[model samples]
Each structure stands twice: as C-alpha cells, then as structure tokens.
Target: MGRHREYDVDKVLDATLCVFWRKGYEGTSYADLTEAAGVERPALYSAFGNKEALFRRVLDRYQERFMNHIPEALGMPTAREAARHILFSSVELNTRSPEQAGCLGINGSVAGSDESEPVRQALIDFRAAGETQLRERFVRAKAEGDLPPHANPEALAAFLMAVMHGMAVQAKAGFSREMLEAVAEQALSAVPGGGAAPA
Candidate 1:
C-alpha cells in the first residue's frame, strides 16, 4: 500500500495563500511557498504540482475563505444595500490583515511578463466572474423595481468592480479604513435609485 502523506494539505494551502496574497503570483516563487509551507520543494511539487498549479489552488482557497461577502451582498433585498454590503465588506477585508493588505485576486497578477500572461488572465477571469454575478444581481434588482428603469446593470457592475479594485490597491498602499469607507460612500451615492425601497 502507498504510504500516507506527512504534511497537512489544508495548513500548507493556507500558508501558501498568505504568501501569494502578500507577494502575488509572479512575485511568489516555489522557494517562498516551500518556506511558508515548511516543506521541501519536491514535496510541494508532489502534492500540489507546479508553482502555477499551487497558486491556482491558493486562489480557490482565497475565494472560499475571503470572498463570501459577494454572495451575501447579492442576497440583499435592495441593489443599494447589496452594493453597500459589497463595498463595505471589501474595505474591511482589504484592511483586515496588514501583513497581506490587498485582494489576492487583484494582487495576484495585475501585471506580469509575457511568461506570466496565463496567470494574469486567470485573475482577470476570476474577477470577471464576480462582476458577472454582480451584474446579474443588479439586473434582478431592476426587474423588481429596486432600481430605476434607466439604471444600467452592466455599467453599475463595472463601476462597482472598478471601485473595489481601486480600494484594494489603495489598501495595499496603506490607506486607512476611514478613507476606504469614504470612497465606498462616494461610490454608493452615484447609484441610481439607490434609496428606493425594495419591491
């Protein structure tokens, strides 16, 4: 029979996620992951395949662990409330950990060399998926009269995502929670029919 693995996979992945969140995809090397995971290079490869594969796993864990606010925001009764929850929650998350004070999805691969194009694209797709969910939610809100007839779900989703991404960058740059909350408030004020009651 095959021997059992010695290291805990969940713990390793959690440590690796911290490294990636702090250093990003291209910036993080196998050495960084190995050091963070407290494992040897060969063992990491055997368990999680190449660096890219391991980074992908870390992204999944990040979404599962940190991005739960998106779903909760979508379930809000009003579009404005949904947007409020997402923006405020994002501010809390981005600034919660000073050691890794940015979004993994954004910080992971915002910019990279040609060799890292795939990783960059992966992050892009990951973010796009979230935007799609927001857009769909806004569409439902419009149908339910929670938003104005002229409200554009696509534009709203794109705008909200842009603000969220900007806030993540700002957080990484040492912006305070109050500043990010002000930014969220400013963004919320721009939403059409944002004060409307739910239908």
Candidate 2:
C-alpha cells in the first residue's frame, strides 16, 4: 500500500507557486522548491513528479486561484467594462503580495533554455487562451452594439492583453499601485467609447 503524505499537498503547492511566481521555471531549482515548500526532495517527487510536472500543477492552481477575475471581467455588460475590470484586477493582483509581486503565468516561463521549451510553450498557450476569451467577448460586444462597428475585436483584445502584460512587468519592477492604475486608465483611451465614462 502507498504511504500517506506527511505534508499538506495544498500548502506545498502554494509555497511552490510563490517560488515559481518570483522566479521563472528555468531560474528555479530543486533546492529552492524544497526550501519554499518545506518538504524533502523525495516527498516532493513522490507527490508531484519532476520539476516540470510540479510547475504545471502549480500553474493549474494559479489559474484556479488568481485567474477567476478574467472570466468575471469577460461577463461585464460592455467590452470596455470587461477590459477595465481585467486591467484593474490585474493591477490589484500584481501588486497585492509584496513578496510575490507580478503574475505567475507571465513570470512562469517568459524566457528559458531549450530544455524548458515545453514549459514556455505551455505558459504561452495558457495566456493565448485568455486572449482568445477576451476576443470572443469583444466580438459579442460588437454584435450587441456595445462596441463601435469599426472597432476590431481582435485588435482590442490583443491591446488589452499587451497592457496587462506590461503592467505585470512594471509591477514586478516595483511600480506603485497608483502608477499602474494610471497606466490602466490611459490604456482605456484606445477602446471605443472608453473615454465616455468618468474615471
């Protein structure tokens, strides 16, 4: 029979997630993970497999815990509101935790060695999925006349994502919340009817 885990799996994953968030996959090592998770190498391997596998599991947890705002934002009444929600929420999230500032997905694998290509691609695909969701939501907004007919849903979605990504990088660099908020506000100008609402 398999032995029962002496450690809490969720706690280990959370600690590991913070480590991954602060340092990219390639930047992190088994020693770092073990130190953060407070678990032995053998136990971590038994519970979550190799480094790549453990990162993937933590990535899933990040989505479940932190990315819920995206879906909620997408459901807003207007595309502008949806974009605004995502932007502001991102600002809050990116700077909320001082020890782990920035986004897990973006910080996870933006750049890495050839051996980490699969992990990098996984992060890319994960981000692309969010962009696709925004694009679809904007398309619906266009159809509903919430957005101008001339406004390109695809471009708008991409633009919003770019702004969010930039904000994440800025947050990692220690940009203040107010500064990020200003950035988010300025980005709204590009959205059709974005300036119509009072800030």
Candidate 3:
C-alpha cells in the first residue's frame, strides 16, 4: 500500500505548478519538484504516482484556474470582442512576469524535449481546444450577420491562434507590453466587426 501524505496536497500541487509554469516539463527535474513541493522524492511519487502523472495533475489545475479567460473570451457578446479579449488576455498573462514569461502551455510545448512527448502533446491538445472554442464562436457570429459575407470563421480562428502563439514567443523573447499591445491592435483591425456598434 502507498504511504499517506502528511503535507497539504493542494498547496504542494500549487507550488509544483509554479515550478512547471516557470521551467516547463522537460526543464523541471524530480529534484526540482521535491524542493518546490516541500516534499521528499518518495512522498511525491507516493502521492502523485510519477513525474508525468504529477505534471498532468498540475496542468489540469493550471488550466482550471489560470486559463479561465479562454471561456470568458468565448462568451463575449460579439466575435470581435471575443478575439479582442483573447488577444489582450494572452498578452497580459504571457508578459506579466519576467520570472515566468510566455504561457505555461506554450512554454511546455516549446521547451519540451523528445522524452517529454506526452507533456508536449498535452499542451498542444489544450491549445487546440481553445482554438476550437474560438472557431465555434466565430462561426456563430457569421451566421448572425456579425461578419462580412466572405469572412471564413475557420481561417480567422486559425489566424488568431497563430497570432496568439506568436505573441507568447515574442513575450518570452523580451517584448514589452506596449509592443505586444501594438501587435494585438494590428490583429484586431483585421476583425470584421472590430469597430464600435452603431448608435
């Protein structure tokens, strides 16, 4: 039987999430987890199974708490507003901390090595889900006459996703908030209904 953990599991997991958020999966060693989680290696393994399994749990928590903006953006009144929300939110999250610049998911996806395929794929899948939600929202907008006749929701969704990923990379590369905001502005201009509604 596995030994019961004496530490606060949620608290430890939250700490572990910060380690992964800063260093990503491949970069986070078991020693790093033990030190960050305030637990011994055996205890971490006993509580969370293995490193991969523990990372999966951490990723889930991060998505739930830190990624709420994705859903909030999708639920906005207009598709243009939705895109604007997502773009700005991405910039905010990716650039808020020099200690953890760029997104946790994108950081993992970008930094993960071959041995970390599962971790990389998990981030990719999470990102794909966000794109799917945005695409569906844009599709609804097109049906409701919010978009021009020739606008393609699928392409627009892909474009926004690409721009977002680019923003993450740029943020990691030391671009400032003002620089990223300019990029967001350029992307917003391409949105079919980006302007204010008629009086």
What are the models' TM-scores?
0.96, 0.95, 0.92
Candidate 2 has an lDDT of 0.89
Best by TM-score: 1
Model 2 Cα shift for residue 117 (angstroms): 0.3
What is candidate 3's lDDT per residue for 130-151, written digit by digit as tens? 8899889889888877777799
Highest lDDT against the true fold, candidate: 1
The best-first sequence of candidates by TM-score reads 1, 2, 3
lDDT of 2 at 42: 91
The TM-score that candidate 2 achieves is: 0.95
RMSD of candidate 2 to the truth, in angstroms, is 2.5
Models, CA RMSD each: 1.3, 2.5, 2.0
lDDT of each: 0.92, 0.89, 0.86
TM-score of 3: 0.92
Q: Could you give candidate 2's per-residue lDDT for residues 118-186 as a string of tens digits?
A: 899999999999999999998988887778889899999999999999999999999999999999999
Over the full model, what C-alpha lDDT does candidate 1 score relative to the true structure?
A: 0.92
lDDT measured at residue 188 in model 3 versus the true structure, 0 to 100: 91
